[model samples]
Target: MEISMSTIAFGFIGFKATDFAAWDSLDYISKHRDQGEWTGLYIAEDEATAKGYLSDKINNSGNGIAYLHKVSVIRPGKLITCLDQSFKTGNIDIPALKQAMRDKGINVEDTDKLTEKLGQLGYYFRCFNNEDGAIEMIIPVELVTNVDMQLYKTCIAKSFVFSCQ
Candidate 1:
């Protein structure tokens, strides 16, 4: 489960060899695979690639994939996905999240202010636990727009989160 989630996240950065997006668009793309194929969100680079993959799966393996969807992974705003068990107890692993951001060359000082700014923009953290003893923070792509660049640039000196092709 952890591996699947990480793979999905990495897809946003174009790390997957064959791009695969969820057939149901954003609805199934972020869900766990245990919920069945219909609920599983696959990652793809674009619509053509996603369609090709879907065709192959249905033709070759008789997969019940009748529809394909194109979703916009690129958003004007950014949401941080944090995986930590402490979130289940209503506590956030702020230090870990900040350190991860720092490792990505994003300036994450003034953590409180950073979160506050995100909250002001209606991009609050949504925590999820798959009973894997870790919480995953995910934001719907629709709600990931209207970013305040002024505050974003202040906290992030450099980051791929805001860079998309």
Candidate 2:
């Protein structure tokens, strides 16, 4: 009973809102803020690494199963709009930051505009504080085939067999 591991590019997609209406409403941003569920795709090097991270960081109270998909060989493109350590000190100036990004040719006036642009490109925008206490806003573009249900089932079955042994 040996578990096989490979260095695969994995993608984890999470939903901001439960329904499409809530996601598309004018107050969608506020909803996400209030619910604290604006997370996007998290890429990991392999299944084991992703499982460990997701179990610790994502699977709250052991109630949720992490959705991990084997992505294509093409690495997802990352567009880092902001990386500010001042946010850790609670000195974030929103307007000034937006102007700065505009000056940097990012073409984004606000978070909403950034989300819209990313959505149009079939990508997801996520903002969070990195481990070093820096505010990071990133857009992860998913450039791969859709999840193969049969393959996923086979992988799960093999994992179960290996674990039970």
Candidate 3:
């Protein structure tokens, strides 16, 4: 599909650690590693600029898929979250982000696979464009069990901070 400059420029924001109790958007999941649940708190950027840009992203595509074909970011001191998953791998050197294209069906990806080949990579919240110019995100295995958050691990399976839909 041909993407106009306006469409390409549009995108949504994922406030991974933010929560919106007013909107009732937060889930009740306890574990970040649980299946099909977002494990972190994420805020939607509703500012006019963000909302407008994101609107374009939503209309210009079908679904969003994450691709990890680049290993350059695999080094230490950085956290990589899986916003989408669509790539071939071994040691997961991964691929560079391709030019933004029409959204496709959201890919079902596991966080463990990406973290399996790294030396020092911690998982974190990721953001991308899916329907409505927003994509889903999840924490990698490295960030699954935090030493400090162990007490509240049994909260449920809804964290919205990072996980699946």
Candidate 4:
């Protein structure tokens, strides 16, 4: 599983496959895939992506199975903080980032507070963990309107992946 906090840039709205029928149905998948770059329906490749995508889906659609909803998009520089399990140990440090932010006169007590504040500003948090123990945390600083901190908290609580708190 992966855990961290950061920001994202854009959000995508579309349908997602929910069952074996939807998963195995090439025609259905193809049709949705043809809609746009990140539009239509999609089958999550792993538990992490599914959890992240589903949480966003539920927040937007109130359904976890197959549904249409808005999902955040993260690019390289858009992330405020990223805790990636794939990175070599000690390569990227959260504390260092915090210090850097503080050095730049950004009032950041810690990563959690920083992320929480960012969340209020249209950024959403995502945690993903595959069955293989791979985990990642992402906080996308996108333009989310009427930000729902409670919904995000609930989503994190229900996520099968690691919890933020």
Candidate 5:
């Protein structure tokens, strides 16, 4: 993700995705995707373009998204972005899940493997459709590049501030 520094840029700036208010949104992808701490850094900064950009990036970047992100725009003009998805069953407690991945550390293979692990963990497997199933996953800030996500948000924020259309 990239953002313009010369804009009305304000994001959950941190080295880790756990620091973001939207950190919990990662669970929607798969509770265990973040097990390796690879799920955070998906928040948007109240701009439709920004949210759309990140969504495209996450989908195209080999994440192979299972959950769909919902961008809720309030009457006061605040965008409440939420991401949710279905889980695939697999191994959940691999040693690789001990910490988060580094920059460019995430891949399609990793995400697929994580889905397997979530199934193994039972948390992801428990998500029931049409019955309001509960899935519990923790998204620490150490997963994805908070800087990149913030940059995207900032750029879109700036562009929105300046654009007439």
Candidate 6:
């Protein structure tokens, strides 16, 4: 397929990481290595960006079916959420923010710390309703190709196809 800048859009780089959830212990990586491609989907702008993102993981100390998925749009919908995962991971400094709260005489704990404490108190993944506060993205996302890990790492594609409908 003849690749174009417009044709190549959103891509997701699959990776391995131990601390996928806030409840996971900090020592989790040391105690037990991740067994497979982690559940969290790290989305990138395109194939090149995905390659750059996954380059370090290729030679890392674990083996799994690493992938770069070219997601083509079948239909688009507004993905509305109160917490955008990307924003939290990219912008927020959870530890520093927690410290700032404590400094202000408000005994604040990190989400992980709070989650752990709450778990001990028999509370799990609690939710509360909020009005008029939301974040939404209309991303057309249907996997177009499971672009080979080798192709992505080596920066060459011999037999990968992309189809957008």
- The C-alpha lDDT values of all candidates are 0.34, 0.35, 0.27, 0.36, 0.27, 0.29
* Sequence-dependent TM-score of model 6: 0.26
Q: By lDDT, who's the top model here? A: 4
lDDT of 1 by residue, 1-165 (tens): 011112122113211112223223333334432342112122333333333343343333443323343333343444445545555564655666656656755565543444443334444343434333433333333233321111001111122121112
Model 4 has an lDDT value of 0.36
TM-score of 4: 0.31
lDDT of 6 by residue, 57-161 (tens): 333343322344443323222121224233333443446634643564434466535323322222212111122222211121111112212222222222322
Task: Please provide, for model 4 over 113-143, each residue's C-alpha lDDT reduced to its tens digit, 9 standing for 90 to 100.
Answer: 4454443444333322343544343332222
For model 1, give the 10-residue run with minimal summed lDDT. Answer: 148-157
**Model 2 lDDT per residue over 61-120, tens place:** 443333333423234443433445544554656666556646645465565443444434
RMSD of each: 15.6, 11.7, 15.5, 14.4, 17.1, 15.3
**Is candidate 4 or 6 superior in lDDT?**
4
Error of 3 at 104 (Å): 24
Which has the better TM-score: candidate 4, or candidate 5? 4
Q: Any runs in candidate 5 off by more than 4 Å, and if so which?
A: 1-38, 54-165
Scored by TM-score, the top model is 2
What residue runs in model 3 are displaced by over 4 Å at the alpha carbon? 1-30, 34-120, 135-137, 141-165
Q: Model 3 Cα displacement at 41 (Å)?
A: 5.6
Kindly report which residue stretches of model 4 are placed more than 4 angstroms away from their true locations once superposed: 1-48, 51-78, 81-97, 103-105, 120-143, 146-165
